[model samples]
Target chain A: MSLKPTPVSRASPNRAGATLDAFLRWREASIIVVAILLTIYFQAVNENFLTSANLETVSQFIAASAIIACGEVMLLICGEIDLSVGQVFALAPFLMHFGTNAGLPIIVAILLALVACGLIGAINGFITVKLRVPSFVTTLGTLYILNGVTLTLSHGSPVETGGSEAMGNFLGASPYAEILWAFAAVAVMHYVLRQTRWGLHTIATGGNLIGAAEAGINVARIKIGNFVLTSVLGGLTGILEAHRIGSIDPLAGGTTVMFLAVAAGVIGGTPLAGGSGTIIGALVGAIVLGVLRDGFTLQGINAYTFDIIIGAAILLAMISNIHLGRLRRGGGR
Target chain B: MASALRADNIVKRFGSVTALDGVSMHVEPGEILGILGDNGAGKSTLMKILTGYQSPTSGTLQVHGQDVVLRSVDHARSLGIECVYQDLALVGGLSVAHNMFLNREKLRRFPPGMLDNGEMRRRARQVLEDIGVNIPSVDLEVERLSGGQRQAIAVARAVSSDARILLLDEPLAAMGAREAALIIDLVLRLKARGNLSIIMIMHNYGQTLDIADRIMLMQRGTVTYEKAAAETSVPELMDIVRREYRAVRSA
Candidate 1:
């Protein structure tokens, strides 16, 4: 009468099929299958798709988006979003540059830049939470403000990334460095979301704000902390990109990257409506997007056509995810 | 024994509008007290003050014979006061065990900040079992459960925290007869434990009489009537309410 599973599981005597059904019922399962199929198709389309060099190139694309998606997924699950994170991404390397100009060491400059980004996130959080402005509008305003600040500081010109070659390689110049950072971010965030109280509170905050508050979960702090995390991660991704390209462009990242990160999260099964999300699922989504971009580029698809196809792919993924989500919510009975 | 809770001449005002006006009530230890009222009768305001969701403009509250002013919901909980709201206060996306532990999660020592999910699940199961809640599994998200089950979980959470005073705001509202019966049984079970003092703000007359040991009726921000539930009938309550309605209309 208590603590037992529903009759559905007992009625099915085939254990293996039941296990497989459960696996498929997971939110990440569909995306993982999609990523695998894309990988095989790309490899078949072009021999170079699986080549180590080409794989590294594809990973570079996944790296930035996946890292940002990790933080965005957390924010989304908590019912907030940071549109200015991409702008913060464009701002970090320049802040680091100014730090070095002020006689700070490279590492110190990088840390300072990240700290500054965290402050920006706090501002975003305060304005959204305390001022009662919607987060989207708040971040949108910061997005423009950050962009203008970066452009004015750089005089609208690109600058060579100032750190030593060794530092550069450590950040993102090496083929695997950026991807490694992304993977690390994913692993730590996955643990946080699944194993820590902070993550559980974040989910609860999004699930039902009044309910979370009634339970004494400190909903505001959870939202503010996630905002800070998203900004810092965004800054880190920007710095990595600057080092990888050996130059910092005032226009790098901006809206395109933010949208891609958000798209990855949604495709990974984190709903825009909030309350639930999966970090590993975001990584798989990033992989799917990366495979499409790099694979099409390898097959010589034009950039314009690629955008159209990517747009269509995102739509298809979202529609399928919505249906799959029904199965998930049905408890797989 | 001292009453488990006592509110002395409580008054609450929202700007120029008075919500609760010089109302006083008390509930004996191990007793189920039902507060009945219509909409805008200050029932919610009084419940809010009791749960420390809001402060009274003028009043004194005594819990276990100790005079106190509750500062916030958490402060009230620290004094062993817990509320199961009409909304149930359960996260739809969270598992039953997760919702039960919520802010007070059990943590593993070695990992420093990681949740001790296994321990939480065990304790949640024990608590639910002890309270006689027939949850299918603690791992199921609360949204998957029926309204009665969700209400039961909310009560289980309150009891698990050792709440000496339990407040339920419209626990049976919008529920079917069977669902309401489930909660009624659960409430009776808690009362039978002989420790918790229960206060339910309700709109249903017959149901309140069936469950509460004593009942108080509120009208226009004041206590209009009070009596033992065993001595009150549905028609008697309806006549009183109708008289009050007529008086308001004539005035």
Candidate 2:
């Protein structure tokens, strides 16, 4: 009996076209192309745009947002969001500062701060999943509560974290230190999201909660775990930033950081609607924003213009992502 | 031959509404028991109870003649009861292999909870091929598949899990004739294996008569009739259904 050929044929002539098509269809491919083009344009406009020192500075600036984005990507994939991540980012550092002044060991202080963030994450998860409250509302309430507590505790002033000099050096002495943490978060998170059962469950939870539950997956656990993961990552980013910057600024990570991290994830092709996401995509998204901001600054563009350009870029990326997703479903050419 | 599954007087109630009223049924090893019911006939509720999606209000469930309490779908699965739901319970964003191994994923030795994707992919391909499913790749996401292929994948997933008793809820619903035929053929092939017992809930009497060894007709949360398939005819089942409908309309 003659067997019928499969729909996805692998003939040699079609293979070449298919390879190119696969590249074009990948969500990150367009973003990479845009980043490269932007780099070329920046190089033409300014001599210092491609300098190693300048690149290092860009990496330092992007690292915190990148770290937060890594967590946000996972949460978003599981069909939820944490608007309070920005507050956790600021609150964690202040908690650390208070811990150090209270005579706790530095590592102990950091752990306490992270624990606080984890508690907040648990609260968010409990309210959202158990109480059936919308996550957007739950996290918004958390954002205010955390912001209020941080402001009241620090009295809206920067706390001088008087730690050992070795601690400071170890935390953020090298320009690459914070960037290394960001990359480490990305690498670890990427592995968890792609190569683990936990990640698969997360995707399934977001894709179809009822379906996943019927399949014997613990949907609540997956969602709650993601919330905790995002908040802990946010707290860690705050600690690293505080150590690098030499002080815990009360108002350091406001809604701007939260928005930027969320935007990075969205720009990286992680759908806000959930079901699908990638950590590597978020990392590249952070770099794209970093390169844009750095290049525009080098070209003497006003800082205010950065907002307009970045906003437009996010919209464009979203449009392309939607189209690419449709193409993958064989909806349109 | 011993029975594979036995549901004794399964009763389900949601507040004042009674969904399944003392429904008792059984399927012998390798036999296909066809459940025939209309809307609100408690067909789905009974399936849910058997599959551990929901607990029966009051019932004794037996698998291989041993009484067991299924606390959850996972528990049911552990007891070798696997269900292919009408909606298919598939994650559209996940690849075919990933969806097949949804909660029962294989972990790598080194990473300790990491998915063994390569192994899963290989096994998924082999299982689908062994089952004679004509799919190009297991790497493709389920959303890209046609309705028939998607149904096939769901059945393949259930069967590959070593389920001794398979519960198919409206497997041929909303499917084209060819797709329905494909599923029927798959079901027959599984029956030929002789280790698996099948309980298929279907709407079509003729189709049910075509594949089932025994036929069960349910109406208003109760079984109205049960008979050997060879002893019952479609017109006889239709007359019984019409009588139930007339009684319901009068009530």
Best DockQ goes to which candidate?
1
Question: Mind sharing the TM-score for model 2?
Answer: 0.96
After superposition, the stretches of candidate 2 with alpha carbons farther than 4 Å from their true spots are: A1-19, A331-333
Task: Single out the weakest 10-residue window by summed lDDT for candidate 2 chain A.
Answer: A1-10
Q: Number of the top candidate by lDDT?
A: 1
Judged by whole-model lDDT over C-alpha atoms, candidate 1 comes out at 0.92
Tell me how far the alpha carbon of residue B234 in candidate 1 is from the true structure, in angstroms, after superposition.
1.2
Q: Which stretches of candidate 1 lie over 4 Å from their true place?
A: A1-13
Model 1, position B230: C-alpha lDDT score:
87
Candidate 2 local lDDT, residue A208: 90
Candidate 2 docks with a DockQ of: 0.56
TM-score of chain A of each: 0.96, 0.94
The DockQ-derived docking category for candidate 1 is medium
C-alpha lDDT values of all predictions: 0.92, 0.89
What's the TM-score of every candidate structure? 0.97, 0.96
What is candidate 1's lDDT per residue for A8-61, written digit by digit as tens?
333345898788778878879999999999999999989999999999999999
Deviation from native of the Cα of residue A327 in model 1, angstroms: 1.3
